[model samples]
Every structure is written in structure tokens, then in C-alpha cells.
Target: MSPQQKALVIPKKQGNFELSSRSIPSPGAGQLLVKIQSAALNPVDYKIRDAGLFVTHYPAVVGTDIAGIVEELGEGVVNFRKGDRVLAHGKFTNDFAGFQQYTLTDASFSAKIPSSESFDSAATVPLGLDTALVGLYGDQLGAGITPPWTESVGESKTPIVILGGSSSVGSYKLVKDYGATHFFDRNLSGKQLLAAISKVTDAPIELVYDAISLPETQSVAWELLANNGTLVLTLPASVKEDEGKGRKVIQTFASPHAPQNNELCQSSWAMVEKWLSEGTIRPNKYEVLPNGLEGVIGGLERMKLGQVSGTKLVAHPQETQ
Candidate 1:
């Protein structure tokens, strides 16, 4: 029999998660077998449980944010060796998922963790950062803006507004690190936020990344956007488009494995190591949950209830009993 590992499994669609055992999987070409050290919970984790949104298979494992150590390398994977500390964006498949003691990661979507960062911190970056990136740069899925890394896009002077939630410190810090010039308290009304933006620059607000994407926030973002401007949303747009105006609303899909986003994400993933090492990008602040994999259940419950805020909740998969 193959080696087995503890895993959190959902037995059916919209099923409760339970502790179970599964055989460890081997990495195929262009992949690495990873012993998961940390896995971070996102709102999507609970959403999948409640809505059965993505998974089609029974007894599925679903998690996407992961940081761990390389246990073995597969064919054609020359960038990493055994025991390297790494972080990866996991998939919904049982073998590739993060809610397990061991999982497989595609080499293209994985990056080495720098000495300055921890598994917990590294686990927070993949999902959120990729979502933001795809929303900003993807032509089909995003605003199709030139990425900041390209030659003198002149977006530095362009005014951009982000409508984030109250627990947006980590997100705020990330945008600032990437060149956001202004910050507003979430309590501000749409009119107040527009007024604040007016004082900062005379430039029309061309881009609004509605990270919150609530109906109230989306209404505000739609109101603030200029003619021909783009509003990027993390959720469905609650506001209707004005046909006469050239404005567009994009609800970004962040999966790195999506065919439309594959090349863009690969290029971005290539820069992640450098970004972390030089402090050009930083990880989100996180809180560790108790009881390893078992702790994930309660964490998901808290997320479902909107009880978790500001910080990412992480679980130690290795501590599973």
C-alpha cells in the first residue's frame, strides 16, 4: 500500500468536513510532492462547503493557499530539490489540494520561500495577490491595464480607488507597497470617498478595484468611475452599466490554472521570489488556528459567520492527529 496521510475531506456536495486518511500522491512531470506545513483559509473555502460551487467529485478535498517543504521532485523539475521550503497556489483536486498532510504542486505555480519569511506568511500571498494581479492585468478577466513592471506605464500618477472592507490592513499595506497613493477609512460614505479622491488629484478616477464588492461599495465605485473607466470587482457587479458611457465592470477570476490566466500567472509567479526577497511585495498578516487540520472546521465556520476579520487564518497540517 502507498503511504497515507491525514486529510480533511468533504464526503459529498455541501457536506461537512471530517478528518480522514488518504494515500499520498506522487508528483508527475513538472510537479513536486510537498509536505504541507501551513494552509490558510479563505472565504471561498466555506463558500464551497455551503454552495458546492466548484467540486464535482465526491469525497473531495478543497484548499488553495499553501506553504510547505518539498519532499520529492518530479521529472523535468530542476528548480527545486528535496527539503526546500516553498509556497504554492493549490487546486481543488484532492491530490493538488492544500487540506492535507501531503499534496502535489505544479512547479510553475510554486516558489521558494525566502529566509526572511515563514510558512504561515508565505501561505497568505498566493490567493490574494494573484486575485489582485489578475484583476488588474488580465485582458479577458481583468481591466487589461499594463502591468506596473513594464516600461513607464505612467500609472503612478493615475488615480486609483480601492473599496476594501474594514479588515483591510493587510490589503491596504500591499497596495501601498505596489504604489497606492491614498487610503480611506472604510466607514466613509461614497460621497465622502469621492470627495477625498478629488482633493488628492485632478485626474479622473480611471480604475477602481472594488476588493469588497458589496452592493453598497459597488454602487459607490460605479458612481466614482469616469467615462471609459474600468471598475474591477471581486464579486458580481451590483450596479448596471450605462450603455452610452464606455465604462466596464470586470469580476475577476483568480485561479492560476485557468487557461486564460495561465501564462500571465506563470510570468508573475516567476517574479514572486524576487518580490519577497527585496521586500517589493509583502505577505498578509495571519493568525494561526489551533488543532492543526481539525481546527480548519471551526475556522471555516467563523469565516461563514463573518467573524474572522483583518488577518488570514492558517492551520498547521503537520500537527494533524
Candidate 2:
């Protein structure tokens, strides 16, 4: 029998999550077997169980944010080795998901965790950061802006609106650190947001990122967009397109595994270690849950109830009993 590890699995579609034992999977070429130390919970984790949105198989494991140590390396994975501390963007596949004691990570999407960071903090970054990255720079799925890494990308004093609640960390810092000249309360209505934007700059609001992506928020974003502007949404777009205005609404799908995003994410992942070390990117504030994998159930429940706020909830998979 192969070595087994403790995992949190949903037995069937829209089923309850329970602790189970599963074989530790081996890494194939260009992959690394990670002994997961911390797995962060996202709203999508519960949404999957409640709505059966993504998984196609029974007894599925679903988690996307992970930080851990490399247990072994597969062929041609030269950047990592046994015992390296790393963080990765996990996928929907059972073997690659984060809700398990051990999982496999694609080498291109994994980055070494800095010495100054903890596993819990590192675990909060992958999904949120990648969503922002792909939305801002991905030509096919994003606003088609030039990435900051390239010399052609110049600093613009243009006013951009980001629709979401305030977060001192996470995506707030990501946008501000990247370059956001003004900030507005996400609670504002379309008219109020336009007034707020007017106070900041009149540079013609060319870009709006609706991080919330609710119907109400999407309406506000659509209202504020200029002709030929772009609106990036995290959820399915609720606002109708106005064809004559030449505006575009892109509902960003944040996954490194997607073929369209693979190369973009690879470039971003390569910069993650340096970004974390230099404080160019700040991980979300996180609270650690108890009882390891068992505590994830309650965490998901809290998320489903809209109880969690601002901070990310992380579980220690190694502490599973």
C-alpha cells in the first residue's frame, strides 16, 4: 500500500466534508510533492460544497491556497529540492488541492517562501494575488494593461476605481503598491462613487476593478466607466453591455492552471519570493484555526455565514489527528 495522509473530502456533490485517509500522491515531471503546513480557506471552498460549482468527481478535495515544505521533487524540477519552504496556488484536482496533508504543486506556479514569513501568512496570497494579477495584465482575461515588470509599462496618474470594502492588507496593498492614486468607499452608490472619483482626478475613468462583483457593485462600475474603458469583475458580470460605447467587461477567472493564464502566472510566481521578501507584496492578516484539518469545517461554516472579515482563516494540516 502507498503511504497515506489525512485529508478533508466531500463524499458527494453538495455533500458534507469529513476527515478521510488518502494515498500520498507522487509528483510527476515538473512537479513537487508538498507536505502542506497551512491551507487557507476562501469563500469558494464553501460555495463548491453548497452549489457544486467546480468539482466533477466524488470524494473530492477542494482548496486553492497553500504553503508548505517540499518533500520530494519530480524530474526536471531544478528550482526546488527536498525540505524547501514554499507556497503554491493549488487547483481543483484532488491530488493538487490544499485540504490534504500532502499534495502536488506545479513547479512553475510554486515559489519559495521567504525566511521572514510564516506558513499561515504565505498561504493567504496565491488566489487573491493571482486574481488581481490576471485581471490587470492578462490580455485575454484582464484589462490588457502592460505588466509592471516590463520597461514599456509606464506610471500613469490616471484615476482608477476599485470597488470593494477596505482591507489594510491583501488586495488593497496590492493595488496601492502597484499604483492607485485615489481610494473610495465601496459602499458608495454609482452616483456617489462618480462624485468621489471626480474629487480625485478628471483623467477620464478608463479602468474599474469590481472586486466585489455583486450586481449592485457591477452596476456602479459600469456606470463610472468611460468610453473604451474596461471593467474587471471577480464574479460573472451582472451589468448589460452597451455596444455603442466601446466599453468592455471582463469577468476574471483566477486560476494558474488555465492554459491562457499559465505563462502570465509563471512570470508572476517567479517574482513572488522577491516581492514577499522586499515587502512589495503584503500577505493578508490571518487567524489560525484549531484541531488542524478538523477545524476547517467550522471555518467553512463561518465563511458561509459571512462571519469572517478582513483576515484569512488558515488551518494547520500537519496538526491533523
Candidate 3:
């Protein structure tokens, strides 16, 4: 390994970030040294870059969604070895390292790659897919509806509304494999939205996943809820308007530390891989920007301006090679 590699880093006291060379990391116990092949950009990537909210060190690595080959493994790391292709959502909570050419990740944080997908497409799945799985299919939210895992819910019909259907994460979740669950765009108008929803789910347009945070977009989901139906919102539920009908509102938060959530992420990734391989789910259209670490600022700027439409921006650290 080189003595140092460039990483996207931000200071604790300032909003500005830049790529800097630092010693390439070595895996600790139960950790893997990942030579990042690709790092997909997300909204939170810019948020942390601008706000500097999640930081543990003065000049900390940023961004979470990563896919790469394991260059080396630490003691007791049985699941991965040198040259194994893997993907991981870097931890944002404990100053989870990100955007670096190489970063140390726990074996639990990483997963083996699926053969059918490319490094770029697979990189975008971890964080968004993990969030969707935990929010929709986890025990707390999706208990009654059988997941794709068991054939019991064969051809199951449940209406799912993605409130912010246009965003990168929202787009990935809606199109992701979920047996026969119907999905609707909460942003669409009355008849058009209803028609779309009917095409996919057997549910009576009651259940929803509101990915949009805006009040105007969410109004339809609140009104459409069936009696005792559930609604999952990525934003806080407190701001949600009162639903006269008997309805349940869940605030969705995706984290790496939750045990049940850990399993949920794994399951969701596997499903995504299956769908990707079988052509059940179309890969999200992405604007591929093959840049080394120096391109972090430009990528975040495009993300902030909403310039990336229907396409997530991705960075390839391996481009430096």
C-alpha cells in the first residue's frame, strides 16, 4: 500500500472540505482495509460536508455509501479476505470513515458482492436499500405483510406510496424487489396517482411510504390512508397532519448500530442483488463521475442544487489508479 492516499475530509470547526493524503489505514481486530472502488454520493453526504455535524476527528473522512475490494483483513475477520469484492455503508454515527481511498470497516459492516452487478450500481444500493428494508419490512413496520423471503405471501398485494418518489433513495426503494407490493407516487395527482397505485398493489391505497419531507407532497398519503393502515415517513412524524381515519404513523430512521436493523440491511441487500440479477428491478440511472478524491466538492455542489435528476452521482476512487 502507498504511504498515504487522498480522502475527502472536513474539519471539525469549518464547513469547507478537501481531499488530502494520509496514511493508508490498516484493519484492526475484526476489521477490513477496503480499497474503495466506488463511492456513491447521497444528500447526507453534502449535509455533513456543509454542516460538519457528524465528526469525531479534526479532519475527518466523509460520505458513507461505498463499494470496493478487500485489500487486507485484520485478525478474526473470517467473512472477507484479500481481493474479495464487498460493499458497505460507512458509519456516520461513530465518525464512520468515508470518501477515503481506503478506510477501515468492521466485517459486520461489509458484505460479499453479487456477481451480476457492476461496482457502480452495487455501490448505490447499501444505504438506501438498508433504509427501505428496515423501514418497510422490519418487524416494527412490515410485520403482517410477509417479506419476499417466504413464499407464504405468494403474490402478496400491498399498496406502498413513495412520497418523495423522485429522489435517489426513494426511486431505488420503489423499484426494488418486493414480491407483488403495489407502489404509488405520492407527488402525483388524484386519478393519475390512483391508477398507478392500482397497477401494483392489492391494498386499497391505504398503506404508504412517504419519502418526501414536504407538507404539500405528504397531504395525499395522510388522506389516502385506510382505516388502521400504516404510514412510514422519513421525516419526523410530529409534523404530520392529523389523519381523521384510524392510522399509524412511523418515523423512519436508518442506523448501523441497531441489531434487528443489521439483519434487515443484510436481507435487503441480498434481495436487491437477486432483483438486479433476475432483471426484476432496473438499476437506478446514475450520472457516473469518475474522479479521484479531488472531485468531492464539485459532486456535493451538484447534489445540493438538485442538478442530478433521476440519476445519483458517483465517485470512483480507483480512478486514481
Q: Rate the local accuracy (lDDT) of all candidates.
A: 0.88, 0.88, 0.68
lDDT of 2 at 160: 64
Name the lDDT of candidate 3: 0.68
Residue 121 local lDDT, model 2: 93
Q: After superposition, how far is residue 215 of candidate 1 from its true place, in Å?
A: 1.3
lDDT tens digits, residue span 246-307, model 2: 99889888798999898889989999999999988888889999999999999999977878
Q: What is the per-residue lDDT of model 3 for residues 77-196, given as tens digits with 9 covering 90 to 100?
A: 886779988878787632246587887776776777678777788677666766666677777644235466645555534556666656665775665453434444444765567666
Ordered from best to worst TM-score, the candidate numbers read 2, 1, 3
lDDT agreement of model 2 with the native: 0.88
Poorly placed runs, candidate 3 (over 4 Å): 93-96, 140-145, 176-203, 241-244, 266-276, 279-282
Each candidate: RMSD to true structure?
1.8, 1.7, 3.7
RMSD of 2: 1.7
User: What's each prediction's TM-score?
Assistant: 0.95, 0.96, 0.82
